[model samples]
Target chain A: MSDFTIAQRERENVQVLELKGYLDAHTAPKLEEAFQSLLNAQRYNIIINCRDLSYISSAGLGVFMAYIEDVRKNKGDIKLSNMSAKVYNVFDLLGFPLLYEITKDEQEAFNKFAGSAR
Target chain B: MKDDVELLSTFADQATVAIENSRLIKKSIERERLVQEMTLAQEMQRKLLPQGLPAVRGVDIDAISTPAFEVGGDYYDFVELSETTIGVIVGDVSGKGIPAAFYMSEVKGIFQSLSALYASPRDFMVRANAVLSASIDKHSFVSLLYGILDVRTGRFQIARAGHCPLLHVGRSDSAYLRPDGMGLGLAEDDFFSDTIEEHTLQLAPGDACVFYTDGVTEAHRNSDEFGYERLRAAAGLADGKSAARMKEDILRAVDAFIENESPHDDMTLVVVKWLGLTA
Candidate 1:
C-alpha cells in the first residue's frame, strides 16, 4: 500500500501528497490514481512528501514519469522531498534527477514551488 | 484333524498377503498421479519464459531457467515497453515447487501489466514490494532485478531488490554490479537500493551484462559449492556472444563443472549485450 494523503492549498496552488508504505507492483495503482486526480483537478504544482515512503520500485517511478510530461505541459511541476536514500537511489538510477526537481526537505520543495509561482 | 487346521491357516495367510498387495498397488497409482500433476505444472512454468528475445535495436537479451524438481521459484520476463525501451525482470521466490511458482506468477503479472505503463525501475520495485508483502504469507519473500533498457541511448536503469550481482564482462575480465538490497516481501519498510551507477562502454562494444539467480552461484559439487568465482569465469568465456549463446554457455559450463550432478536448487540466467546501434 504505497498510498498517501493529499492536502492542497489553493492560495499557493501547492498540492502535497504524503506517501507511506511500500511502492511496488501491487500498490502502484494507488499512487497512479492520486497523480491522475491531481492532474484532473488542475493541481499541477505538486510536492510528494516521502518522509514515510518506505520503499519504491520501477513501477512506482513509472507513475511519476507518466505524469511528469502532463504536469510540465501545464506549466506546472512535481517536486519530491524527504526522500529516503533508498528511494532516492531508485530515482538516481533511472535519471529522475535530470527529469524532475528533487529537494532535500519539504520546506525547500514548497518554497521552490512558491518562488516559481511568484 | 491336524491336516485340516494347517490348511485353514495357510489359506488365511495367503488371503492377507493378497489384500496387502492390492493396497500397495493403489498407493503406487496415487503417487503416479501426483507426479503427473507436478510434471504438468513444470511444463507450464517453462512456457512462461519468452520463446525468444525481442529484436530490439542495440540490445541483446537471452535467458534460461531450470527447475530442480517439477517446478521452480525463479522467473524472468522481457517486456517491450515501447519502441526503444525494453523492460527486463528476473526474480526468485523463497521456496520451490507449486507455492513458489504461484508466487512467481503473481509477481510476473505485476511486471507485465505495469511495465507497459511505468518507466523507472525503483518505483516499480517499491510498489511491487508493498503488494507482495501484503498478499504473501509471512514465510514468503523474493529477490529480483528489474530494469528498463533504453536501447536507443545504450543506457539501462536497473533496481536490485536482493538479487544476485549483474556481471559486466569487458575486454579484460568480469566486474560485478553489486547493488545494495535484501530480498523483497520480507518487510514493508525493509529495503536497499543503489545510486544509479552508469557504466558507459562504447569503447567495449561487445561487452555483455549477465543476471543470474543464486542457484547458479550456489550450485554444489559434492561438498564444495560452485560459487561465484566459477560463474564469473564461465561468464567471461561467454563474453561477446549472442544473448542466446551466452545463456547456453553458462548452463553448459555449470553442467561440466558439476559433471552431470543434478543441481541442488533452481538455476536461472539472463544476458544482455550492447550491440551498438542498428544501421
Candidate 2:
C-alpha cells in the first residue's frame, strides 16, 4: 500500500500545507481533515506545496474542490505550488488550471497573495 | 483410572465445540453487516440515476445502465434546457461501489444545478470542472460527455472530458467522434481550459449518436475486452433502429460477447436518434 502525509506551517498570514507520498483513495481523508482544520480555524489563505508529493487520483483533486468556495467566500484563497510534472499532469488532465492559481514555487505563490493584497 | 481419562476427553470435546460455535457466530455477524451495507449502497446508487427518459421533440433518446457490483459508478441524465433544446449527459466515476456511488451523486447534483445556467456545452463543462475540481475526492475522478441538442435544427453540440469517444451512425456507416478534453477534477488551471475543446454535428434523418462510459468498451471476457471496434460494429449493425432498440441490441451483443462470464465493471449506453422533421 502507498503512504501519504501532510505537514503544515504559517508564513506571512498564509497557511502552507506540504504533502508527501501518494494521494489516492486510501489517503485522501487525511488531506480532507487538514483542509477542514484550516477552515475551522478561519485560516483560508492556503498554499499547498506539492514538491514532495508522489501521486494523486481524482479523489485527491476533490479535496480542493470541497473547500475552495468557503475559503474564497471568507476572502482567502487556496493556491498550489511546487508540483512535479508527474503530479502536475494529473491536475492538468482534469482541467484544474482554469479554477486555480498554480505557480512554479512556494515563493511565487506567496508572492501572488502578497501582490494581490498590495 | 480409565473412567477418569474418559471423563477428561469428553470435557475437551465439549470445549472445542463451544469455540467453533462462537467463531461461526462472529463470521455470521460480520457477513450480515457487509450485506446490509451493500443493500444501502445499492439503494443510494439507484436513486442517483434518472428515473425515466424525458420526451424531446425531433429526437428519440434511450439509455440503460447495469452495475457489476451491488452499486456502480456509471451515471446518465437528461435536462430540458429549454422548450427547443435538451441537454444529455453520461459519465463514469473511477472505481466502483460505495465511494464511486458517492462521487456519482455529487456529479449528478453538479450537472442538475449548473446545466440550466450555461447554454454552451463548453461553458457548462468549464464551470462544472471548476466546481468538481474543488470538491471531488483526491483519489477519484469522473469522465463525462455532455451535449446539447437543438430539436428543431437537429444540431448537437458536445464537450468531452476523458470519456470514451462518441459513436456517430449515419444512413449507412458509423464512426467514432474524438473530441479533445480531460476528465473533471484532474487540473485546476489554464491547461485544462486550453485542452478542452468542443465539437458540433448536424444530425440528418436516420442519423444517430451514442454516448457511453469506458465500461462499455472495457467489458471483458477472460482476457479480451469488448473493445471500441466491437462497439462500433455493434452500432453499425444497429443502424436504422430506434434509440431504444439500438440500446437494447448493443447491450445484447455485449452480453453475448461476454457469454457466461460476469461483467467486471458497470456498463452504460445512451443513444440519440434523429428522426428529422418529417417524423
Candidate 3:
C-alpha cells in the first residue's frame, strides 16, 4: 500500500529531482523512467533531494546505479542531498557515503556544482 | 427443399471441422516451441552455476543452488585467486525465469573477469557496480556477497551488497554479520563506493559462516514464511557439523517447513567451516 513519486526541476543547469514516498520494487521503474528521460534530453548533472522519501529498497537503489556510468561518461555527475535520517540510513548502510556526494541541503549540492564548474 | 437443407448443413459442418483442426495444429506448434525454449534455458542455467567447491587446506566448503523453476537467477561460485587465497561469491538477481537466468550469466561473467583484477573486495565491488550499472536492465539488480578466504590463516575479508545477512556460528553462539554495502547496479561513483563497507573475520576451529540467497529465508508454508530466525537457528544447531552436513540440514529443514508447498524462489546456500591448522 506504499506510494512513491518523483518531481523534477532545473536549477543552474543541474537537474534536481525530488523523491517522495516509498521506493521499492513496484515503484522503482518510475524512477528509472525519470532518469531515462533526463538522459534522452541530454541532462546529465543530476541532484536527488530525498527529504521527503519515506523508504527505499535495493531494487530502487539499482536505478541510480543503472545510469551513473552513462551520466559520468558524459561528463556529468549525480549528487544527493537533504535525506531524512530514515532514508539516509538505507543509503548509509549500503555504503552510499563513499560513492556519492551527499550534502546537508539542496543549496550545498548546488554549490558543489558551482564549485566544480569553476 | 429438404435435400437443399441437408446439403447446406453438411457444408457448414465440414468448414467448422477444418477451422478447428487448423487452430489445434497452431496451438501444438506454439507449445512445442515453448518447451524447446525452456529446455535450452535450463541447460544454460546449469552451466552458469558453480560446478564444484574448491578443496582448501583447513577449510571445508560446500554449496548448493536449487531453482524453483526451469531457470533461476541464484548463483554461487569459487574463483581460485591464488594458491593461498580463493574468492567466493553468492548472489541473487531480482525476479525469475529465462530473463533472470540470462542476467545471472552476465553477472557471472563480470565476476569472473573482475575478481582477478581487484583483490580488495571493496574495490572489486566498486568496479563491478560500474560495469553492471551500465549493462543491467531496468528494474533488475543483483544482491551479492563477495569474500576472500585465506586457507592458511582462516581469515576472511567480506563485502556485501544488499544481500541477506552473513550468518556466523562461533564456538559460543551464532550471529548475523551485516556489513554496509549496496547491491550491484544500484548506484554509481561516490554513492556506491562510499556506501559499501568491508569486514574481516578470523575463523578458529569450530567456526562456520553461511552465505545464502533470500530464497532460503523467504520459503513459506501456507501463508507463513520460513524466515531468518529458523535459518539462524538451523545454522547454529549445525555448527559443529561438517560443511556438507550443515548444507543438508538447512535444506532438509526448509523442505520440512514447506511440506507440500513448492519453492517460490531459487534457493542457494554456501557453508564455510574452518578446521584450524591442526585439522
TM-score of chain A of each: 0.89, 0.97, 0.96
> How do these models rank on TM-score, best leading?
3, 2, 1
Off by over 4 Å in 3: A1-118, B237-239
Q: Which 10 successive residues of model 2 chain B have the least lDDT summed? A: B185-194
* lDDT per residue as tens, model 1, B119-223: 787767767777777887644577788767777776777777767767877767777776555556644543323332323333246677788886787665754
Candidate 3 lands at a TM-score of 0.73
In model 2, the number of clashes is 27
lDDT of 3 by residue, B1-279 (tens): 999999999999999999999999999999999999988998889888887778877788999888875566788999989987889899988655677778888889999999999889888988888988898775577888988988778899999987787898887788888988877766666787887889998877768889998778867775467777899877764346899998888998999999957786678999988877653
Q: Per-chain TM-score of chain B, candidate 3?
A: 0.95
All candidates: DockQ: 0.02, 0.17, 0.25
Better of 1 and 3 by DockQ: 3
Per DockQ, what order, best first?
Answer: 3, 2, 1
What is residue B230's positional error in candidate 2, in angstroms?
1.2
